[model samples]
Target: MAERVNRLNDLTPREWIRFQKSWFIHNPPPREPGVLVHPGKFPEGLAREFIEFFTKRGQSVLDPMAGTGSALVAAVRSGRQALGIELNPDFARLAEQRVQAERLALGDQAPQARVHVADARQLDQLELPPVDYCLTSPPYWDMLRQPGFETQRQRREDGLPTTYSDDPRDLANIADYARFLDELVAIYVKLHACLRPGAYLTVVVKNVKKGKRMYPLAWDLGRRLGETYLLKDERLWLQDNVRLAPYGMFNAWVSNTHHHYCLNFRRE
Candidate 1:
């Protein structure tokens, strides 16, 4: 009998099966001060889970909007090459600092990680190598700038930044929803050039609400970006540890959204 071939990743059968479940609860641990300086970033642990499941060791992983290099650090931790593109030079420098620290802790066994200071929209100009997997999260359509936004409110009181940057080109600063979606899709489309054929890309995002209107950013991306990359499926990242917020408790039905859509796409 021949040994079974696992083309996607190095996961054992049991681990692979477990990752197939469509929803999971992962409450991120407290952020270290170095990374906490960034306004928004997914946990490195979560990124590693996706990286380990999507590609084997020594493969390359990229995060186009690498806020503080969460995905890059996760790649090195999982024995993969890491590449990242950060728009803000300040954040880019910070990401490099964190990556270097992580690599030093692991010593020579750690894979190489590089963070490029550039906008993701200029992906094609960056001359990046084709990658095996890409995992990233775009800003949630300027939700941080919305007055009285729950998350930003807390961030403000803590003296931390409530928004990504003041750069006019930053997607998080775009005030118009339609324009923001178009530009975001364009950036992802450009990502196609950096992804090897059959590579998978996972986008972690959620819908946003402005007063009574809810914008389906996740669903919209699934449809629009599907034109450039195959819309494979979706997994929900549930956060159960969050303290519930009383939003519109007395007047209307407003849910304390604690789940994020981890939309998976593949380059055919």
Candidate 2:
């Protein structure tokens, strides 16, 4: 029997994107408490896939918006050094604990991973080492605010107001989406100084719909950041685990598919 060599010509552009999505199609099993504490965190499997595809072992990887340190965990698991910066104090502490626990289990050879409680927008002030790759997911604008009150998670946790969706405070607080976008772009721009040339930056973001208005957040991010770095390709992260839409009950048309646009760029 002969070995098979798959050629790029075997698939069309759309097919190639679909193929990549296929590899990550399965839903991540619910995490056990003490293992991971956040729902917004990216799946470790996806983070590992990005780290493996973008860099070699021993290389350094960074995740600025490292919610629960998912990317950091992935980097360490892949034998790459990892650094994460988080804005939320609770999430940062949780990430630090998780990494420390993992280190205790995996020993020193596992990539050194650390998470610091700091604003992603202020990386210039943080003493972070150079990075070979950066993978992160930004907070989806206040969709949790859809209801008048806080999110269940926010409510369950004392003093933590509902945020990142449908919340008035979360959405209303950002009076300038343009400013928010610019600030995010500037953060990555600052991060570019730390990346090795040719290193890849992957951002997972999605468009937002509110009040019948669409914010091309993902697209605009690409465009604005494109000036600082080379705007490369994108990967669509399709979630298959969401409940079916209930458009029939309201006689409305709603999309059941939740997709994240994984934008890949390179430091120039």
Q: What are the lDDT scores of the predictions, listed in order?
A: 0.92, 0.73
Clashing pairs in 1: none
What tens digits encode model 1's per-residue C-alpha lDDT throughout 1-268? 9999999899999999999999999999999887667878899899999999999999999999999999998998889999999898988998898888888989989888899988888889988988999999999999988897877778888899888899998999999999999999999999997899999999999998887989999999999989999999999999999998888888899898999999999999
How does candidate 2 score on lDDT? 0.73
The regions of model 1 sitting more than 4 angstroms off are none
Using alpha carbons, what is the TM-score of model 2? 0.81
Q: Work out the TM-score per prediction.
A: 0.98, 0.81
lDDT of 1 at 58: 95
Residue 149, model 2, lDDT: 23
* RMSD in Å for all candidates: 1.0, 5.6
Scored by TM-score, the top model is 1
In angstroms, the error of model 1 at 69 is 0.7
